[model samples]
Target: MRNIRAIANRELLSLFCSPMGYIVIAFFLALTGVFVIATRSLEPGQPATLRSVFGFMPIMLTIFAPAITMRMLSDEYRTGTIETLMTVPVSDLQVVLGKYFAAFLYYCVMVAGTLIYVLLMLIFGSPDLGSMFTSYIGLLLAGAMFLSVGLFASSLTPNQIVAWVTATIPMILFVFATNWVVSEVDSAPAIREVLQRVNIWKHMELFNRGLLMTESVAFFLATTMLFVFLTIKTVESRRWR
Candidate 1:
C-alpha cells in the first residue's frame, strides 16, 4: 500500500509537470463546451439538459484516455527508467495499480472540470439528478476501462505515439465495432444478443438512461480487471527479461 501510494504520487507529480496533462484537460473541456452549446441550440424546444454532452463524452474519453495514459510505461522504457522502477520493493501488481490509479485520478480531474456544464443545467433547467449521477458514474467506469486498455498498450511498446494509437483503435472498436457488426449482419437472435451484450456503448447508454443495470457494471469492471491483469503480466515479463 505504501509503495503504491508512493508510485501514484510520483506519477501525479510527473503528470502535473508535463504539458500533456493540461492539454488533455483543456481540450476535453473545450470540446464538451462546444457540444453543450450545439446540443442545446439545435433542440431548443427540448428540455434544457446535458444529454447530448453525456452522449458525446464516451467518444471524447476514447481519445483523451489514451492521450493521458500513453506514457505510463512507454516513457519509462524509453528513458531506461523501468529498471530503476522495477528495483523498488513494490510488486508488479502494485506498480500497475499505482500507475492505473494515477491515470484514473487524472481522468477524474478532467471530468470534474465539466461540472460547469452541470451547474449551468441546474441554474437554467431541472435536470434529473438521478440520471446525471448515473451518467457520470458510467463515464468514470468507461474511462477506467479505456485507461486500462491504454496501460496495456503502453506496456507493449516504448513509443508513446504507438501506444496512443494502439489504445485508441481498440477503444474505438470496443465502443462502436460491436454495435456496427450487429447492425450490419443479419444474425440469429441469440448471436445478436451476445453481440449487444459485448457492446460497451450499449452499456453506457443504459447508464445514460439512468438504468443502473448490474450486467453493464459487471461488464465494465470485468474488462477493466482483465486489462489490468494483462498489464501486470507485461510488466512482470519485462522484469524477468
Candidate 2:
C-alpha cells in the first residue's frame, strides 16, 4: 500500500510538473467551452441544462484520454526506464494501480475544471441538480474506462504515437460503430442485443438522462478492471523477458 502511494505520488508529481499536463487540461476545457457556446447551451433564456456539455464530453475524452495516457508506459519503455522501475521493491499490480490512479486523478481534475459550465447554468437558470450530478459521475466512470484502455495500449509499444493510435481506434469504434452495426445489420436480435450490451454510448445515454442503473455502473467498472489487469500482465511479461 505504501509503495503504491509512493508510486502514485511520483506519477502525479511528474504530470503536474510537466507542460503536457497543463496543455491537455487547457485543451479539453477550451473545447468544452467552445462547444457550450456554439450550441447556445448558455444563452439567456435558454433552458438551463448541461446536455450540450455532456454531449461533447465523450468525444473529447476519446481524444484527450489517449493523449494523457499514451506516455504512461510507452515513454518508460522507450527510454529504458521500465527496467529500473521494475527493479524497485514494488509489485507489478501496485505499480499498475498507482499509474492508473494517477492518470485517473488527472482526468478527474480536467472534468472538475468544466464545473464552470455547471455553475453558469445554476446561476443563470434553474437546472436539475440530480441529473447534473449523475452526468458528472457518468463522465468520471467513462473517462476512467478510456484511460484504462489507453494504459493497455501504452503497454503494447514504446512509441507514444502508436500507443495513442491504438488506444483511439477502439474508442472510436466503441462510440460510433455500435450504433452503425445496429442500424445496418439484418435484424438479428441476439447480435443486436450483444452489441447494445457492449455499446458504451448506449450505456452513457442512461447517465446523461440522469438515470443511474446498476448495470451501467458495473459495466464501466468491469471493463476498466479488465484493462488494468491486462496492463499488469503486459508489464509482468516484459519483466520476465
Candidate 3:
C-alpha cells in the first residue's frame, strides 16, 4: 500500500511538472467550450440541459484518455527507467494501479473543467440535476475504462505515439463505429445487438437522460478492471524476456 501511494505520488508529480499536462487541460477545456457554444447548449431561452454536452463527451474522452495515459509506462521503457523501477520493492499490480490512479486523478480534473458549463446552466435556466449527476458518474466510469486501455497499450511498446494509436483504435471502434452502425446502418440484428452492448456511448445514453442502469455501471467497472489486469500482466511479461 505504501509503495502504491509512493508510485502514484511520483506519477502525479511528474504530470504536473510537465507542459503536456497543462496542454491537455487547455485542449480539453477549449474543445468542450467550442462544442457547447457551437451546439448552442448555452444559448439563452434554450434548454438548460447539458445533454448535448454529455452526448459529445465520449468522443472527447476517446481522444483525451490516450493522450493522458500514452506515456505512463511506455516512457519508462523508452528511458530504461523500468529496470530501476523494477528493482524497487513493488509488485507489478501495485505499479500498474498506482500509475492508473494517478492518471484517474488527472482525468478527474479534466472532467471537473466541465462544471463551468453546469454553472452557466444554473444561471441561464434550470438544469436537470438528476441527469447531470448521473451523466458525470457515467463520464468518470467511461474515463476510467479508457485509461486502463491506454495503460495496457502503453505497456506494449516504448514508442509513445504507438501507444497512443494502439489505445485510440479500440475507443474509436466503441465510441464511433458502434454508434454509427447501430443507429445508421441496416445491419443484422445480431450484429447491432452486439455492438450496442459494447458501445460506450450506448451505455452512457441512459445516464445522459437521467436513467441509471446497474448494467452500465457494471460494464464500465468490469472493463476497467479487465484492462488494468491486462496491463499488469503485460508489465510482468518483461520478466520472462
Across 1-241, the per-residue lDDT of candidate 2 in tens digits comes to: 8888888899899999999889989988988888888889899988788776787777777899899899989998999988998898888899889889999999999888989988988888888898888898899999999999999999999999999999998898778888789767777989998888877777778898999989999999999999999999999999779
Better of 2 and 3 by TM-score: 2
**Cα displacement (Å) at residue 186, model 1:** 3.3
In terms of lDDT, the poorest run of 10 residues in model 3 is 178-187
Output the number of the lDDT-best candidate: 3
lDDT of 3 by residue, 53-109 (tens): 778888788789999999999999999999888888888988999999999999999
| TM-score-based ranking | 2, 3, 1
lDDT of 1 by residue, 182-231 (tens): 88778587888898888877888889888999999998899999999999
lDDT of each: 0.87, 0.89, 0.90
Please give the distance, in angstroms, between residue 50's alpha carbon in candidate 1 and its true position after superposition. 1.5
Measured by TM-score, the strongest candidate is 2
Candidate 2 differs from the real structure by a C-alpha RMSD in angstroms, to one decimal, of 1.1
**Per-residue error at 213 for model 2, in Å?**
0.6
Candidate 3 ranges beyond 4 A from true positions: 184-187
TM-score of predicted model 1? 0.95
Better of 1 and 2 by TM-score: 2
